[model samples]
Target: MRNKGPKIIILTASYGNGHLQVANSLYQECIRRGYDNVKICNLYTESHPFISEVTEKLYSKSFTYGKQFYKLFYYGTDFIQNKKMLRWYYQYGFKRLTSLIETEEPDILINTFPINAVPEFRRRTGIVIPTFNIITDYCLHSLWLHDDIDKYYVASNELKAKIHSRGVTESKVVVSGIPIRPSFSQSLDKSMLFDKYQISPKKDLILLIAGAHGVLKNIKETCETLLLKTDHQLAVVCGKNHSLRNEMAQLENKYRDRLHCFGYLERIDELYRIASVMVTKPGGITLTEATATGTPLILYMPVPGQEKENARFFSEKGAALTAKNQEELLNSIDSLLKSKQKQLSLQLSIKKLYLPSSQEMIMTDILKESEKISRMKNHSTIKSQKKKLGS
Candidate 1:
């Protein structure tokens, strides 16, 4: 039973953690469903190492220092005409990826990254594999569109309509919210989590996430504002940012037992469950996970391009509130903390947006598509053999 499902290869890049996170979610789902030969590949690092390294550095630098430049680059390649040049530049990656695909010979290919590797692979090797493109962001980018893809999993109906408007058939698009790790959708006992984190169950909890790279600007000021302005206890998760963790540690003494700072914890679901509200950047994966947990979010200074779009989508959906500056951040947090009605409204909105069974739906669709493709291939092969025999 474990080895019964099709061989799956999920291709993702490290331009941001969102893509890889989505890929990993799908990989985990496949394994959970007893798919034995599921493989996750980091396309950029495995197939194009030097390019991935340089682009990752540039990506970090752009977000940290040159956001305007990053936005410019994001929009520049978003046009169909510009995509030709972009594809030409990535010909080397295409070839390397095609070689890797030839070696693996997967039954299906799932791409969480922007690059349409499946189409390029078919163009080069003439192999037609069932392909799925899981768009990690709320909005659709032209780079994620590919004629050869059999299915597209989008975050919303608006995104599905947008893709349909771009000439992709409506049947090919599925409005499945971005798949998050299954743990986020699970129910955790609040008292247990409170005891585990050593926080008082009597007080409301505020969770602050500085993101995976720890790039939250003015985190100290934000923390101070939360402490001074609100009555709730603060839990700050500085993911992979040791320096930020160390800096946050000093506040423990001044604030006494109200402050909790952690570097990285695998069981983030527990924290999400205990916290009444979350303050973080609007990354696709983080937002999806928060929504899964029905935690209202205060999106702080999302980057110019995709993050802004994600923030806008969630804000419009009533799932989150956007805070562009410290004043807005403080005000938004204060408002949410004081108003139970607003908090409940946000929680309900998030519940509507979050698809708890997205992983299962995605896996079912992929398997169905793979079976269709396999049948077609077998039929074609049979026809060819019969024709040869008759001739």
Candidate 2:
């Protein structure tokens, strides 16, 4: 039997993990709330695997070789959102996306990725499914905008105002914060974390996060610096980068007493709770999760596009500090570890960056929208029947 509850389709991409992370957070919360018809579609990978593969490689390589080109592409496209020209993109996944929609009969489509196709399709095809775009970063891009989109969910009030300035009505925008998993909002036992990871409570814990399907640029050097320069214990979570994981394992053995290395983890909330500070690139989801845990951050060399923007947003808000290079990153971490007052101040600022339960609040808003859309649909159906009877 099919679930008669609200049917939701969350559209996301895995170019990096941030977009998919938000989708997963919302999907998990939906299931936990007993909404059985919620499904996630990795729209790009599902629709055009070849393009997805090529672009993903370019995205990874952009960190090393093509950052200038990447910056140009980002700012160039970001500055001009050609809705007319986006018709080129609107057709890329049209068949697969429409087929999924037809099969699932979703009441609403939520985008964690800036997939403007749904809105473009709506404009062209006259379908009126309520669509919400969750801007997965602290910044706004014109690509995330469309008149057909019913609502906009944003990471910050600054982002919300930015969108508003771009002609999206203030009423249509919600400052929901970035949707991190709710587990991060609660406290975990530091003693248990230390025992499980076999680390000492005597040393401050520095966490290095190499994101899913990504390698830290100059990771070996970064790890070596932390070990050699400070009395702190280091935990590196190299997510899904098997080669980096293997490398970190070798380093772990060399510094067996102080270095702890891990591969991808299903639940990282405990590690977040136990960390004195996080040293990572400024990915939106990683930053959001860190803030939710109230962990002080030393953002390491944020890349030019969204990474730089995210770092700027947090740094401006006094929630986190940014480091320009390995030396700077080490210095920031050492200073944070040495100064108890600074750590407390940073933690307090980070805490203010997050809402209490972002996932729950977002889910609640989605359901409320779902109910409103259902009522509008029902009223339309009854009106159509009445009109037919009079005719």
Candidate 3:
């Protein structure tokens, strides 16, 4: 059934979780602003059940066999000779999603994932409503470049420039950072965060997150070396990796007070809030969140395609330090821990990278556009009524 109030349907995908994170942030901000008719849905689940199932199998394969396969798929985009596949997906995929839009007749539509953006644009023909694409990554992708897309909400000026380089109109891109959880914009008591996690504020705390599927091959060995060779306490978050969580729990028992292990945690913002340093791959969303919380980054084992590029961009800007292997990872961690000056410098760099109010910025843009459309419709209706009375 259609909602009685105005609706804005947010579409996201589950491949890496960044898109979903961006979508959720927009949802919360809209509701806070009294747009209670907003709804969130998984794009693949709703429109393409068979394709979603296949994508899940492919994701598991990449996670288990090797992430290089996923990298290969991302890199394989270079081979596309033209926009043939893009046009096909626009027709088939967008057709499947039209019913929801027709049923709700939303005032605005938001696309948080690139895979969903092109199709959305194609489906929007003859519709007067506004559409916006909130890109959740630092880099632009082929799937994100389309003339029909009205606005592009980007993470950084660098990405905005890159999107323009891909032949998009400069007027269409907005360099608003990726939307993050609203809690990130609020100031939190660091000590309270530490207390909540039962971590000591006196010692430097490190947060280690395995990517969605789990740790890099050398992460376990790296964790052991840090705990044994250095004084910094480590908290490892193995998200959705039951086996890795169990293994880390066994190790934590031996280390006692120094090591903490967690799985599928809800309060990740708290972890970032309390941590002095963070060790993880440079996923766009994770890095953005870490910056929001002012946590220093030690990026390790970045995958070879987009992640590698993300790591380079971060380290060059001094927001993070990169490690080539176990020895280097240990050395980098030790160096950061040993120097109070270095830690302070890193914190200052993180502050420079912060875009704390992106959720507000993106949502505000959407509302302004919707209001403009509403005013235009009202003016057009009055014109028609006047003409009918004169006739």
TM-score of 1: 0.94
Candidates sorted on TM-score, descending:
2, 1, 3
What digit string (tens of lDDT, one per residue) describes model 1 on residues 336-360? 8889999999999987887778878
- Taking all chains together, the TM-score of candidate 3 against the true structure is 0.89
Task: Give the distance in Å from residue 203's predicted Cα in candidate 3 to where it truly belongs.
Answer: 2.1
TM-score of each: 0.94, 0.95, 0.89
| Model 3: colliding residue pairs | none
lDDT of 3 by residue, 1-391 (tens): 5544468888788777778888999998887887779988786677778888788778656644767888887766634537766556556456546777767677777888765533454455655567678987676667766656668898778998888888888878888888887777677788787878789999989888886767455667777888888777889889888999887877899888999988887678888888878888788899898878888898886776667778888888888999877778778888888898898888889778878689898888777776886798789989999999999
C-alpha lDDT (0 to 100) for residue 263 of candidate 2: 86
Which parts of model 3 are misplaced by more than 4 Å?
1-5, 60-64, 78-81, 116-125, 373-391
Q: Candidate 1: misplaced stretches above 4 Å?
A: 1-4, 89-92, 384-391
List pairs with backbone clashes in candidate 2.
Answer: none
Q: What are the per-model numbers of colliding residue pairs?
A: 0, 0, 0
Winner of 2 and 3 under TM-score: 2
